[model samples]
Target chain A: MTSSTERSERAGAPAFALPFRVGRALAFHELRERTRDRWVIVISALFALLASAVGLYGRSAEGNAAAITGPSLVTLASLFVPLVALALGYDAIVGERERNTLGLLLSMPVGRTEVIVGKFVGRALALCLAVGLGLGAAMLAAAPGEARTLAALLGPTMALGLAFVSVGLLVSTLVSRQSTAASVVVAIWFLFVFFYDLGLLAILVATEGAIGDELVSSLVVGNPTGLYRVSLLASLGGENALTDLGLDVSLPSASARGAIWCAWIFGPLALSAAALSRRALR
Target chain B: MQRLTLEDVAVRFGRIEALRGTSLELRAGEVFLLAGPNGAGKSTLIRVLLGLVAPTRGTLRVDGAPVRADRAFRARLGYLPESVAFSESSTGREVVSFFAAARGAPKKRIDEVLERVGLADARSRLVRGYSRGMRQRLGLAVALVAPCELLVLDEPTGGLDQDALTLLWSVLDEHRAAGCVVLLASHEIALLESRVDRLGLLARGQLVALGDPTSLRERAALPVRVKVAPRADADRDALVQALERVGTIAPVRGARALELDVQPSRLLELLDLDAAHRACIADLQIVPPPFDEVYRRLLSEAA
Candidate 1:
């Protein structure tokens, strides 16, 4: 039976031409290989568990039983998104170079651009899967309360998580060593999650709140994590009340905002690809 | 036809000239061996061919077309790098498939190559568990599966047992038999001497010597030394004349050593006949200078 199947397969030529297949195949292979990491699985599961616990606790505290509101979902994302994105992307390109496999990959009928883009995409998909699984648990914890609200929040949050992943990939290309890549990625994470807000608060204190709404909006856009927070908040609830805050919180039109976020996503990818091609193999 | 050519190809890492105005060509189906000491720009030359490093000057072409990083250009090469490491998490089979898939390989080719490299049973084993030799074989397997017209391998047999070496040789033979051109960079002269058809010696980033193995061996100009006891009235002039007739000969006085330049192929012929000649010979040793010596002398001349 196997022999017959082999014969039939041999008789049927490959449908896709080699290059496109290679790009997709490499992407898929990485997706599977990285998914097998026990740490990734454990941390993702634990994060999901924590999200469930938080959602449940929040639901109990509120009198009305809605799955999760804009603030709670944003809170959950703010806590865990950077951790996952940094972990996934920190070792992407540098790890391959250190392993001596970069030459092997580059020598084949594959483009450095394809490799850079494909790996980032593949790893982004893996991060999405893990985040999706965790978010599913978080949604369940918001169950019987605000399931609709929790569902509403997932779309924009994942997109924001994806942007963080791209930034991680960019840093990986710049750093040669895996440990160094990890350090820089973790540092970026700290700046976004903890430092950006603190620094903003300090700036507000120093200027006697001279930084008005306009500067605040630009600063939020510059901070990847802060942009994610505002975008997620806006996506989940139609009430754009977050825009009125003293933190320079004006959301641009969706199209303009989408372009800004897309740049955040693809801008790093393009820059990293250039850096990778120009890198000396040594 | 010149299947591969490098014209005045020069490369530099900062001020260090890794390859300097190197040029050579290999006809299809011929095995060209690159031999040089460490830091002689052999790796640089290979990188130029693979398009890994652009030359500081000169041009390289494969199959009469310029090589760039475009997909169509990369489609034509199979490279087996030295000390190729796999992702610590990938199985041997998956690693091969990943590379093959990167080139859009058919599934059957993957299994065929794995079996060809003698890693069929260990297909499921993670690459981290592989021994150095096993990784080398797996690397060979990856290089083989691609539909490449030319195989550019750098030090393909750096770390292998005799059995593994034999397998690698057979793999090379298979490719050559299939009319594939192979350009190998290596320092293992003995194994490559019998295997490769043409040899190119790269010294300090220049192509100093290039020819068949027989031609290289002949070019060494090894000298044969003979110590003859002086017979009271032996025809010393005739003796010198007789040795000269056999080949180029000169005399060193203190030990009465007569040196005749001879190729290794003609050493035995001279030995058998010199014994028959009535010259009183005290001692004789056919001293063939080391390959390294010939290589260095050639580079010095080129410089």
Candidate 2:
């Protein structure tokens, strides 16, 4: 029952505390909304179904079952992670704007950066949880020794989700309409998950070895999906499918791969914050 | 906050100017209303004050100390947008609590605000289940949940029913009584005329008139109307001749009556005529200039 005067005085208490509290409140609200919409459950179920099928299929096939399953899981995750991440984040900001809630939310004692970061944190957590549960279930169902490889694959899968979700947020900020943001998100997914590697391979074929292995390696490391595949494949000592395609895909060291993943996760998020700051919330 | 001032503030969206060098001040304990036609920049001005839109020129000051509308500055401000929306899946209580926590208000204040907005009974229901009026009430609950030095509401009465509108006015009164600066943009001029302390009429991004209702009416100097019904056997021609000398007279439809539009200065003379013609007039009623009339006149003048 603190009086409003007492509460008003607290406004000057600490700058850090207010943003942190506001960010946490916004994040929790986002998580609650997603949970109520069954987004977490649906995505988790989809991942579990797909991951189990991929795991069982890889176990029946080839040399070193664990190594095979690990790369196989990474491949599955690279495709699904971007799609799911984009779906979760495509309308994050634009949807609010469309619903006419962005202005009210912005009017609160919350920073624009806090809004973007809070949403990212919330969706990232949901993504990690859903993917973790699905992959965890798959790992448990795997043969005893293969569980380690699946476990090792889980972190990179979540990182890949973070990277793509950040990209989705950037799209949400740039577009004014929710439908446009959604369309752009789909385009981004297609470009990254499918067309990117196809275009790279097309370049190799088109150039006829004019593009050196060093340059192709740099290109591979540039895309989040490519980095996820190379880093996990290199760490698990599994041969890459791209290498098998006669591309001579040399993977960067684990640390460089990790650093690039960090950049992927944060770069678009920074841009989104900048875009939101410049936006007229009305 | 004793005084919040917008010093010659102008906001431009690309080549189009939304607000043009408009200066205004809102003092504590006063309910200031912004009235304007569509595209008159009422909403834009509100956004600028909320810090959602930065002014392309000029400054915003709180109590004579210039400040940016950052989170710290907005900390003491409460706002309800023209259309208040929340997640359909969230319950009334959850929505209120989310905003309350974001504003750093105590948790107990959530229920208090819900009760204040008459949503306590519906607190557990999802927003999707709430009626539009209920949704507006929930929006008001969120805005009022935290204590604020300045409360800004845009079109707050849009979806509100009579009961909710009455509740809103009462809550606004409480805020004003508590020395909160209540700034609202609304088209409910007639309803708000008596309640608001001052009115700013914006036409084409300019404040055409700024004063309380009485002063605004005086400034507009629009004519007042007097409706008169003549006796059955009275000489209507003679009554019209006397009324015409005082003011312009027009026939009242479907009645043996005449409507007189007279300037305020001539109202006493018209009333004296009505008194002299009481034998011929069965009824006479004087209608003062309404707030709507003043608003229309001011806007037309500015246009």
Give the number of the best model, judged by lDDT: 2
Candidate topping TM-score? 2
TM-score of each: 0.84, 0.94
Q: What ranges in model 2 sit over 4 Å off?
A: A1-19, A38-41, A56-68, A237-247, B274-276
Cα lDDT tens digits, model 1, B1-303, are 237778888888888989889988877778889998888888888877776777888866666765554555556678988778887788998998887767656778888999988999999999889999999899899898766667888888877889888998897788788677798999887667788999998888888789997677567655544334545555566666666656677556554556776645565565555643555554555665556566566666667
**lDDT at B192 for candidate 2?**
94
Q: What DockQ does every candidate get?
A: 0.37, 0.52
Q: Which pairs of residues collide in model 1?
A: A65-A145, A66-A145, A66-A146, A67-A145, A67-A146, A67-A147
Q: Which stretches of candidate 1 lie over 4 Å from their true place?
A: A1-19, A62-70, A234-248, A280-282, B62-69, B223-293, B296-303
Error of 1 at A99 (Å): 1.7
Q: Of the true interface contacts, what fraction does each candidate have?
A: 0.59, 0.67
Interface RMSD of 1: 7.2
The count of backbone overlaps in candidate 1 is: 6
